[model samples]
Target: MTKEFLLECERKLAKSYVCTALGRDDDSIAITKEIAKDIAFEVTNSIHPISMETAPYVVAALRTLANGIEKEMNPLDKEIARALQELMGRFQFVKEEVKVDL
Candidate 1:
């Protein structure tokens, strides 16, 4: 990815982080979807290196976000949480694959 694209992704993720931290469920969900889109773009285009080192931090943030919203979550939010969890699973799989390759 270009510097601009990465910066934009960082901005979106930051916004989502703040929204989640502040208990803005609707905004957090929207921003999380946007971040997911960014991930999709990175996956499809293969322009940027995926940082395995960041996986743990991302997973932790997602867990915290999910837990914070668990009480008020509707079906859609639950589905989104499932999707995020799946993404973390994929990250773990990739990390293991890399370790095996090494």
Candidate 2:
């Protein structure tokens, strides 16, 4: 089940983020897959709609998690952290737009 989730994340990231840079780095790919899985799990399990105001909080939390992961001194994980940061930025934008439309 977790493998399926990671695969879905990989497909989503490839289609949406076009993370071509991750192709050469297996560790980065794995880290990105894990991040995507976490995001997917949150999205699936949450009941409340994600608001623009809440997006930053979510990103901060993820950043904290990424920071902990970075302690391992893996450069590939840093790339994944950067990508996750970018994803949060984009999510914030979309959430802001949705909030305005509501």
Q: Please report the candidate that would top TM-score against the real structure.
A: 1
Candidate 2 structure, TM-score to reference: 0.36
What local lDDT score does residue 79 receive in model 2, on the 0 to 100 scale? Answer: 82
- Please provide, for model 1 over 40-74, each residue's C-alpha lDDT reduced to its tens digit, 9 standing for 90 to 100: 65754452333576557666875686588786889
Give the per-residue lDDT of model 2 (tens digit) for 1-102. Answer: 367876776676664444446455655555556666577556535524556767688778867965776898678867866777666554432222236454
Off by over 4 Å in 1: 47-102
> Runs in model 2 with CA error above 4 Å?
11-64, 93-102
Clashes of each: 1, 0
Model 2: per-residue Cα lDDT at residue 45:
51
What value of lDDT does candidate 2 attain over all alpha carbons?
0.60
Q: What's the lDDT for all of these models?
A: 0.68, 0.60
